[model samples]
Target: MAGDLVLLTGSTGFLGYIILTELLKHGYRVRAAVRSQTKAKRVLAGPSIKALAPTDEQLSFVTVPDMTAPGAYDDAVQGVTYIIHSASPIPSFGDGEPPAQDQLEESLVKQALKGALGMLESAHAKAGGSVRRVVMTSSTVAVVPFEVYMGQGTEPDRVWTSEDRIPVAPGPYGFEFQAYSAGKAAVLNASEEFVRTRGTAFDIVSITPSWIFGRDELVTDAGGMRAGSTNSVLLGVVLGVKNDAPYGGNAVYGPDVAKAHVLSLDPVVKGNQSFVLNSMMDWEDAIAIAKKYYPDAFAAGKLREDGKQPTMALKWDASKAKRQLGLELAPFDTMVKEVVGQYLELLAAEEGSK
Candidate 1:
């Protein structure tokens, strides 16, 4: 299985790139499905990818401009032994006004369903002979109820797990998070149903991870690091940024999520199952973790000692991930140090350049 060709989507994204590297590190050749050659080139040039220096046979790219298009992955899945479908639309976490309700559903909900379903359809129809497993990148939001994720109502007393399924919330979403959660839940449900009903030769493994944070090699400069995806949310705590509303205190390290995806490829691991990968995290604890790990950053005023970030302590049962994938999830402290450490490194580099 070491040299099996694996088709990977979302190689240009934060988690996708890490999954790419993990695949390569474990001796699996990857055929990355990128949106464009430019994005493919960027992944190759990333520090982690560049360090590996994957050979042509070990790493190559296919331009899949429109994943939601019919038969989008038909050609890409050819001759591939495994499919890691991690590509999906993400909501913009900027300061601007949120998109309209119709627009949100279209972009977040409809597009996600189409892309995921399309990939599975292609795999079943075209590569059923070769593809053994399809490891999908899902999210914790897919398992948790929308009201709990949105903080709209009372929090659930029980711990959420991979087996938990939440109905896709009806549209007219008030904000980005609600729509995003609906999209994930929709995809997870659709993906599992497709495999169960169709009975393809291959099985499906859905990896639902919580807030992922770690060193993002794609982020080059200080500014990019500060505004990076979920990593930014963690780093923002150190930079004295506060969330408008508190988010669930569930988190998983990036590499662990990636590793779980790779590990799921093993035939020994039973398929047609979902794995939740996360550990309970306290957002405010990031402040103390940052100060403890890298006191110099705070002393230099590079990281704030008085930053405020609200935390909603929600319990998650990720035991299935550990038991099945044999993954040891990283705690919030490791996540904070990695994010803050990388930001400080980039900040120092920026200062030196100036």
Candidate 2:
């Protein structure tokens, strides 16, 4: 009965779209919350959703455009027994001429915190009595020392546990990455704050997934999808968008991350908790896997071998996710193969269309 009826926000996002299919595959009835019901239907009716064929009377959509609006999710969670709050405002560069760095950081942090609090407060008021669990899609930006790991600053690497403080502010400003990290950190802090004061009406589990790599089924074959910065690293490499730039980290397969969200709904789980998730592969290893598996892409110069490896490598402790959620993270090579292979197919489709 845990999967009987669930309300899922962010159904239109890359991760949320995948999570939708994963939930349906697990036999759950999902009430997708999207900004536009028509757009959601159009996007979902494509080959990707058709391939999955997850249609059911229970699989429906409700419009919630302004997630930050007061009582936004109140009606959405009316009859739902479970919730997966994956919908967070991903920072974008916008049309042209980037805004002031401080302003961008402030806006993103505010929006992220507002959206998170909206979902938490709504769930507490509307669905608290009956909702089983709320699984939030937090990012590794909330856990790892990205400023230190990425060499963006001189901050020393701190021992990061679920209880560690997330520093997203007070100096080390000016970069979009830092802004995004601050936003993610704000969400995590907000989740803990909600749990501590709100008591245990419903269990909240926040999953902090590192860079997610895999073919995005929702994106077109021409590779014009608006993937997040984390995913854009690999996709950008494959599409020649950032051929010379090497980016890598503790990466995880996108589907594996989705599967973790589904697995977190076990009834035995209780209270509030957070888990870091990732595959044990750095950037160089992942690229090697791509070149080995999809030689054609590499040969065509679309997938370059010139990307740089990280000077300061970092490792993630995903044992908590494996232990608590029973999730066995996918291998680096396998995920690389899947992502590259799928990109190749998309490229071919694009060429055929032209």
Candidate achieving the largest lDDT: 1
Against the true structure, what is each candidate's TM-score?
Answer: 0.96, 0.88
Error of 1 at 63 (Å): 0.3
Give every collision pair in model 1. Answer: none
Model 2 residue pairs with clashes: none
- Cα deviation of 285 in candidate 2 (Å)? 2.7
C-alpha lDDT of all candidate models, in order:
0.89, 0.73
lDDT score, candidate 2, position 319: 85
lDDT of 1 by residue, 132-203 (tens): 999999998998887875567655687777899988999888877889999999999999999989979889
Residue 282, candidate 1: alpha-carbon lDDT? 82
**TM-score of model 1 vs. true structure:** 0.96
Q: Where does candidate 1 have its weakest 10-residue lDDT segment?
A: 93-102
Candidate 2 Cα outliers beyond 4 Å, as residue runs: 46-48, 93-102, 150-159, 167-172, 225-229, 238-248, 309-311
Q: Measured by C-alpha RMSD in angstroms, how accurate is candidate 1?
A: 1.5
